[model samples]
Target: MSASDDYKRLQLALEAAGLDLWENDLVAGKVTHPATRTFQELGYTLEEVGDSLAFWMEILHPDDLPGVGAALEAYRDGRADNYRSEFRLRSKDGQWVWYANYGKVMSGTADVGMHRFIGVTFNIDDRKQREEELTRINQLLSAQNQQLDQMNGHLEKLSTTDPLTQLCNRRAINERLHRLVSTGQPPSALLFIDLDNFKKINDLYGHDVGDILLCQVAQRLQSCVDAGDLVARFGGDEFVLVIRETGNSASPFRTRIEYLCARILSILAQPYLVGDLMLSTYGSIGVVCFPDDGWTVDELTKRADIALYRAKHKGRNRYCFFQPNMETELQYQNNIETELRTALKTRQLELLYQIQVDRNLRPVGAEALLRWHHPVRGLLSPLAFLPDAIAGGLIHDIDELVLDTACATLGKWQQDPLLRDLTLAVNITARSFEHPAFADTVMRMLEKYRLPAGKLCLELTEHLKAQSFPDAAHIIDQLRAHGVRFALDDFGTGYSSLEALKHLKFDQIKLDAAFVADITDNTTSQAIATGVIAIASAMQIEILAECVERHEQLEHLMRRGVDRYQGYLFGKPLPQSAMEAAMHSTLGAQMA
Candidate 1:
């Protein structure tokens, strides 16, 4: 076929395939239109095209107008030859639609020099619209994911924070402090703050008012800090401030922090506005600089802690900077800690039994209290080594030792004709409840000693109930299934709400010594103890009052109807040999 016939056939084919081809004479600056139905499909009509190229240019979307004009100009000035560009065109309905309109020089002769431009306009508006929609949808999804991630992060923060005070909790603060020091950051400071006699307010008025007072204290603490400084809730009635960027001149920062501490104390000195109840409170603070105080977070906290001890020692409502002598004391504490670890390894620990008496002053069972009869120090109470052991991560070792000893001691006693009926009670730490091997460990101890599971009673302190319930409940279920009973020790001390008490399946509630000590003189204590007794009776859980020192205290506690009384009044804690002798005498007396 001839070239013109071939072109004609191709145009016919293009028309059949739903495409339109057209030409413009750049030299003449005139435009020509080729008939096609695709323009109608895109909301455009043939009657809309004007006779000049200027007419089509007028319909370009404003944003696309400049570039299209530039391209055409480039072609006309011979700066560009072939042209392919995308521009939005106003459809017949007057709405702008993007189009891919490309062209090539077709009719231009070399002699006439490239004046004719031919091109096809394809309706790609649907594809472009779908692509734009997809882009927009992707952006929206990305933003939603980012927001979700941020919300999750906020939830995590909330989990580790005290909601009312908006401060990091003891757990969070300790973790962050450990991380900061472990990272080997050179400069930092730890300031410990404790609200003085906060309980007196709670006792005089109510916890609601006390809560309001604490919130005010938190606000004051926040106000005292600069941006980016961290203030955390070290625990009940205590808070901590970590100064990360104190600019190397820690003294000035320390002074400012001390001033803040003084300000906090002063704020509490004023009457607290609690629902028309005017109340006054006080606070104590201790400050310690990093490296100067100690290298590790624990060391720094320990230094600040000793300073806090001194503040409380000198009297409440004061502030104390850690001094050289304080470091000396810390060194002594360190030496004690080292000695404690060695003592644990050498099995120098011992258990003392404190007799438990019923309302009739009859001895029933004895509590297994841990005592460290140090090689050189003679005898030391659990308080002496327990805290240091917990701090040094040796609590598990100590607890295991206590558990094994108690089991062995009780197991031997169970074989005795006289002491066989005695129940052995052991306290469970928070770590012990969360320990994955707790049930297994108890079972193994029981098996090793050939003791009945029912004879072994595990005492979990009130603080364990304050932890998350799912795991605590699971531990309870597992241990209870092994015929082991549970006791809530120090029952009135922590999170003592009915909600907390009801969640744990405690077989008994050990009244804290504080309540027992006050039972004789304090009416409030009497009422509280009565209420506790009533609750235990209703729950069918036994009640045991601790620290029954005086005969009057024992009489009052018995009258209040406590199931058992434990204290010096019965007998001070005795060594194993003493306990065995006392047991034999009691058996002989009972037989008589």
Candidate 2:
């Protein structure tokens, strides 16, 4: 087709499609496009919109002109195949609106007369608005993401902290240790601690006082360790500490932990007063070295726990290291746990009884002691397996069995005319006292055995005297209301023992074996025993001395006017039948 005919058809299509078409002859610097209506709509006359290249450039926004010029130059230089531009332009009403312009090279000839170009423009105000809206949305989403990341960091901090003590939690400390090991950090130490019978503080004063004491203890721990060290709460009454080192055991790190343990023990040993209540506390600490004793979290904690067990076993209120021999102890503990589990299943546990005599040497009561009849190891005392059972959560089952057997035996013993008036004493641990079902369990056993509740005496160590006093009081009241009598065992040991006798109704006070065993040689022990006897006498509370082995200790206790005496001097713990025979042989003559 002829150029004129082709131009006419292009103009017709541009008009129909809402596009303004134009052509520029670069060689002559002239513009030509027969369709003049589009430019007229933009307030330019046909003559004004004529083939001058300058006219199009003049209409563009100043900032957009350079880019458009570069595009044209690039196309002409054969560096590009097309040119496209978007910019603001004046409309007929003098208002500026966004417009799009696009064109392609029509010829490659260098001759000015032959060079030609074609282009078009369209209104794009709506597209420009949509682009601006998307930019704003992107900015908002970026800001929200940053805020969410910050919130997540804050929540993580909160989750890993102890609120009251402001220390890391057990989980947090473990995670930190795991991270250190995984990242190949230097060696360190783990300090495992347990407050020795912390319950006594709460049982004597109140939980509020206990909480204050805990806060103070946390502060003391912080002061004892370096800033780099971490003190964490492992749970109630237990704490785990992580200490970093300077490659020298002689340095402050190792010494500091030991020093801290001693200082803590000393500080806690001091008596605490909550209002009218005064009490004392102590703690046991276990030490394990990282990369020495252990390289992982579990290994360290396990070793620390083993050491703590040794501390408690050796008499509490002290610190112990994870010695090489501890592995043997650990194995022994494992064996005990296994055997206790088996004993629970096989009903192989037995109860031995020790006769309780009155001040006149007349049998008035008996104490029930648990004995394990191991098929292979012969008989084992409670000392050999009770700790493991308690640690393994088998104490409840053990206590239940002990209670049942004692009730049944009491029922049988009550049938005898002489033993009918005698009471049977049962030792109850803190674990048994904490059992939520303890009341119902005791009541059911008593009912099932048809034993009178008055005939059952529950002996509790003075340990509870320094712990959660309100809870202890509630338990004592509940049990006493059921016709059961309470005895304060291990008296003169706990700081709150005297207060316990005064506040709680106790039918008897068992002088601690420590005091009784040394009464003959230790003037202080004898003085304490004499004072306890006098106090019990004043309160109308009977006194029972345990471990009265020596003639002098027994004679001294007897001279002090104790209500009862029980020890090897009377007879060792024996099976029920043997105890019955002993009573028949010793006291049978008196009855006759």
Error of 1 at 39 (Å): 51
lDDT of each: 0.75, 0.78
Give per-residue CA lDDT, model 1, range 392-472, as digits (tens): 677787888889999999889887888887787887677666667877888898789988667778888755645356678
Instruction: Point out where model 2 deviates above 4 Å.
Output: 1-290, 294-324, 375-377, 512-529, 546-560, 567-572, 581-592
- Local error of candidate 2 at 115, Å? 56
Which number leads on TM-score?
Answer: 2
Instruction: Score candidate 2 by lDDT.
Output: 0.78
Question: What TM-score goes with each of the models?
Answer: 0.49, 0.56
Considering every candidate listed, which one attains the maximal lDDT? 2
True-structure lDDT of candidate 1: 0.75
The TM-score obtained by model 1 is: 0.49
